[model samples]
Target: MKIYPFLKNLSLVYVLALVVSCVGDPIEQPIGKFESGVLIINEGSFGANDGDIHHYDPISGDLQPNVFESANARPFAGLIQQVRVVDGLAYIVANTGKVEIVQAADFRSVGAVNDSKLKIPRDLQVIGQKLFISDYGPYDENWNNTESFVAVVNGLQGGAVHKQIPVPSRPEGMALIGSELWAACASGSQLVVINPATEEVARTVEVSAGSPHFFVQFGANWYVYAMDAERVYFHRINHSAYSISETISIPLANAIYNGNFTMGTNGDVYIITTSGASARVAKVSIETGVVLDAEYFVGSNFYGLGFDSSSNTLYVGDHAGWQGNGQVWKVGPSGSLIDSFQAGRGPSGFLFR
Candidate 1:
């Protein structure tokens, strides 16, 4: 009778252990505060060495400023021009001639590409294992970027310059369409296409008579916006033909010159332009080639524009004339301001996860 009770207790303990094993740890670990949110890239003052990033949570409506310097314990030197996230790392291209790489989730500085050849680097594009940096080249005696080129880095982790492919002047935003890498020369009216395999200029497609600055691809077409002394031109390029298919011009009086733009999920393009201290967003319909709203959303010194497809929201950054802290406004789909949060100095761009 004593042995019977001992056997029963042993069986109960075994069942309890089995139940504990079946109830394992959480299926997913909680993500970092900066991991699943919008990253506001503040270019900072040109000579202040205060370039930083701000994290914003759309769900909680919370803003965390200076996340980059807080995570790395050091200020990000130089003007942060643009940030591109590939795989899980963020390649931050600074105008002061370097590309700083960091973890996209935590903003930890992991590596950088500081080749001496990267002068006034503007943007970054990665294809496969190679990183292409668009540099304005060193300034001449007259301060002209006449030797602009794209520097190629072999790998992301501790990588060096593999080669420098010469392109048109002041290459800015880049896009990979089909198998070719297209770069918009911000100082010329040319869209330079490069062959990634050979790291050479494949060809140049002439756009409207202006400086091509940015590209956004929707469907089988790529939309590019260029600005000249008189007006701004939006060119729709047929990817298969590799040529400009349509050109829509916006008078300078209506929409000023700006390179910041984004394509919405509905195939519409939203561009940001500044006039004096005030900025505006112009909406253009890709199907009809018409400017839908000349001043869809207006704010003070709006310098950055991004469309979040998942939430159908528009995020605009007001740089505050580079005088102090900037602000980011979240606009609804109907062009109504939902909320605004204070960001870092010179908030010029945004990356939404």
Candidate 2:
């Protein structure tokens, strides 16, 4: 008997689990119009064409899986990266090639952008009517930097890359502070600021030696998370000086990975980190720059973290390796487990709607 390519690297014990899931159809409910729920992005196994989005309704305790393909009557190709609900449409960035736009009311396909200029779209941020996306430009055939850029889309006139603003390599997370856009250089140790009006690189702010790959905005300041450095920086941008007025740093024990950090509704910052023994979510005070609680949510094999401000709920994604289906754990604001649902292969991040 020959092993398949996707499962060739699995251990003998885990191979049985993977075969059980692959052979039998996993239970999945048809997607529906969600009144209020968290939209979970599952980055299915690589090359399995299983990347999908699931809606978990807290009110009804229903898990609507594969909402994208079910509503569109077509499978979402490539890896489902990031998703943002703007206006009435949900912009789903499928990093394998394109960004899928769907109706927020009902997970239905509205439009898509897959221009040749998009090399590896990582993140998306909306400003007024424009959509700014960071593309981690891949190395060309010659194995050299291909010049990563931020592609601008006129959301008012359908999704299309009207212009591209060149930036540093491997741009990831992005946030809008007033009229300026702050983008993190994932492979570099700096944050690039761009003027949305001019669509030009205004300036770059140097940070600790690490990849600043994630961000969250609270009030007038911006919280930039340097994943490699395990530090979250509070940057107060001064318009008059065109520089950071004040920067406060919060140190952590473990390196932050994708979907590890999120902000709470009560103005608290929560981040998931591992301490060798177990994965833990830490709550940090925004005002004092201190860890209010070190082990807010603790579990083994935890991969992602998200907070729902409306109901004060905390959602965690646990991936027990690539052998079986992943899980989305629902916990209260106090870190009590409410419920858990079976999600796709890797339930990475959540878009609370």
Worst 10 residues of 2 by lDDT: 227-236
For candidate 2, what is the total of clashing residue pairs?
0
Tens digits of per-residue lDDT, candidate 1, 5-112, equal 889999999999998887974578767666688989888887786788888889988888888788888878778899998888888888987888988879898999
Clashes per model (N, Cα, C within 3 A): 0, 0
Per-residue error (Å), model 1, residue 7: 13
Model 1 scores a TM of 0.88
Error of 1 at 340 (Å): 1.3
lDDT of 2 at 38: 78
For candidate 2, report its TM-score.
0.82
TM agreement with the true structure for every prediction: 0.88, 0.82
Candidate 2, residue 341: how far the Cα is off, in Å: 1.3
After superposition on all C-alphas, the RMSD of every candidate to the true structure, in Å, is: 3.5, 18.1
